[model samples]
Target chain A: MTSYIHGEIETPVGPLPRIATKWTHLDRWGALKTRWSVGRMKYRVRPGIYAVGNPDRDSRVFVTGNFKLSFDHLRRNLEGLNCWILVIDTKGINVWCAAGKGSFGTKEVVRRIRIHHLAQLVDQRKLILPQLSAPGVSAHEVRKMTGFTVVYGPVLARDIRAFLDAGLKASDEMRQVNFPLFERLKLIPVDIFYGKQYMLIVPLVFLALSGLNPQGYSFDLALNSGWKPVVNLFSGYLAGCALTPALLPWIPFRRFSIKGVVTGWFVAVPLLLAGTLGISLMEKVSWFLMMGGLSSFMAMNFTGSTTFTSLSGVQKEMKTALPAQIAMASLGLAGWIITRFIFI
Target chain B: MNRFVYLTDVVTLELDVTKCTGCRMCLVVCPHAVFGIENKRAVILNKDLCMECGACAKNCPEGAINVKSGVGCAAGIINGLLRGTEPTCDCGEGSSSCC
Candidate 1:
């Protein structure tokens, strides 16, 4: 209803807001900001009917969620096609995710069609839904309730043209959800920020604890040695939130937890070999445990962003990995603390 | 070729081929290409490839496909363990990004 909406168009549903297929600088900027978790929750478009181009009753109606990003993708893909865009209220969630949550679902689709008098506005009895929404919507049921057939579109908005050109048929690639490098990279920023609030506080606690030793506390040692743990911690975080996800496919483990540990050591071992962790064997081993444990946990949590991990598979992985990660971190932290208290 | 595959022999996705009715709804909705039509009936072609998002089960009018589907996120699982509820990314605050 802001910059995107240009004019008003009248239909059987009454005067409806019109949006363009153009992308402004602000629109692209909003996408970038949201990628980095800025103003993420509030990034929404008012859910209702939106007209893209001078659409008539015969123009195809494309449905999407209220999330502005979802709307942007759908509209941007609609380039030359004139269509009526129906934005469903999914509480600012993207279509695929909302569909998974059952918000962008059969009930909502039917509800929106009824409330907006979509049947009267469109000449055709078809609603083009994103294929991902099939998880929440029963196409047969929608047809039964709304008297309109649901034709599922491609998984990616970019493939809309191909889908439409193929007589509303989707290719195997169009239906497949991809997790390429760029997509994985784009998702890393938000995950890195997921534990960001704890970033400073956690390191500061270690810094404070660094001053302890057999001869009591020493600020000099804290300044000199504390930075090493800080580095290890940050490197572990980077490996978990960035490296593990970015190199997900290449890593040699089916379990994300183990993959995290692998990537964690891949980065941490270099620092350990450089003798930056500590001089003592206890300190060196403890850093590996802390770093690997932290990274493994963060990487495991990244199962949400992946495209192909199943619920049962993840649950199975978490069963043993979660306990192991906890024990490793706890034992490592306790060992590191004890090393400070005694000269061994 | 299987670079994208997850844990093997772990997915619960099952196909009752008798009741399939060969609608191909499962074939169309599965993001992992887990289903294929064999002899005009749906077959579980790649069972391990199933992320079990439940798209096939929900869209199947014949009720032939069944997979205990839910969010696969570890944070969602931990949250579920804490709350004693089903795995969900919809918990209040902080988890907004999870879903």
Candidate 2:
């Protein structure tokens, strides 16, 4: 029970948790932390009916995923309005992503409706679902199963009031999913931390491996040269996870891998110019390849977060790029290790 | 049109105008504005814009649109490869797959 839930309300179905329209500072803070991947999985409201303001049987029944962020958005947008919210269990995942996984889906929606006795709870046979849920929830199927006519709401939760005020009609722009710089920025933290374990393990291993050379492995040499690979790897992470997304649209090439490699080189080249890369040309090239490939791989994963990429396109790119990336990274690693052994 | 377009000519989305009943449900559900009604029938305005979400195909009453819809996520693809299943993001509790 979060602070958002004020009290309980008696309904025909049962006593349901009541949530407030305004978000407290703590609740707002939770959203920020969730964006940073803290308590992300556990951030969910109880899946069922929640009353916003005082709602009667005639009130609008809005549907949303149980993920707190999704629920918060819907409830917050419903400020000063009377409504009944039907929260579907999405395993603590947001609507769009959960819908993609089929958890915030037709079956789950129907199951919640039946278990909650929604038909008895409301007079109108309507369930206003977020438009993004359409991929998982077939309106026709919901109509057939639960006799509830599904109305797709605007893509953004903030537009919910306007959509309702406009008599459930979304303007053309309301349906569009825009990857604005701000929205892309929000996703940056999560993507950066996506491989936190790898970030740590790789660097520590590199620090130890930096001791290697033709004569013998030396701790003093490791101490002197260890920070070089660390800088390269971290730069790769930032370029792919942060810079690539920030400059996604302006970057050349449609494939995200090429885009990442471009950004990766952009970041790595600065290090080369500063003389941090290495003394040997082979070592410098190896560092560039490793950093660029690391960035390209990270940015390729970003296709998941993007709004416009098709499954076919991603699959095609992965089929070609994945092997190439593996080879590039492997060869770079081999080359770096070789530089430690033979003069280049 | 979205300024953030991806690879072109790669989407599997196919719209059969012959089966379109002019209900325009695809227009309502399509997040990318992929389908448009021309001469009282649905036509794909930009096939490349389609994310293959399958919303249009799923919501179409006439079964006029067809595409293999799934997550375009690389980690999901890798998970599918490892598990020998379709691309899924259900990597529960501390899984690397983003929500």
Candidate 1 colliding pairs: none
Mind giving the per-residue lDDT tens digits that candidate 2 earns over A222-299? 999899889988998799989999988899998999998999999988899987778899999998888888999999
Per-candidate TM-scores read 0.97, 0.97
Where in model 2 is the C-alpha error above 4 Å?
Answer: B93-97
Q: Which predicted model would earn the best lDDT?
A: 2
Q: Model 1 over residues B5-85: C-alpha lDDT tens digits?
A: 888999898888889889898989999888999999999888888898999999999999899988888888888899899
Instruction: Give candidate 1 misplaced runs (Cα > 4 Å).
Output: B1-3, B91-96
lDDT of 2 by residue, B1-99 (tens): 446778888889998889999999999999998888899999989887889999999899889999999999988898899999998765476654465
True contacts kept of 2: 0.81
Chain A agreement with the truth for model 1, given as TM-score:
0.98
lDDT tens digits by residue: candidate 1, A3-75:
9888899888799998879899989999999999888888889888988888998999999998889899999
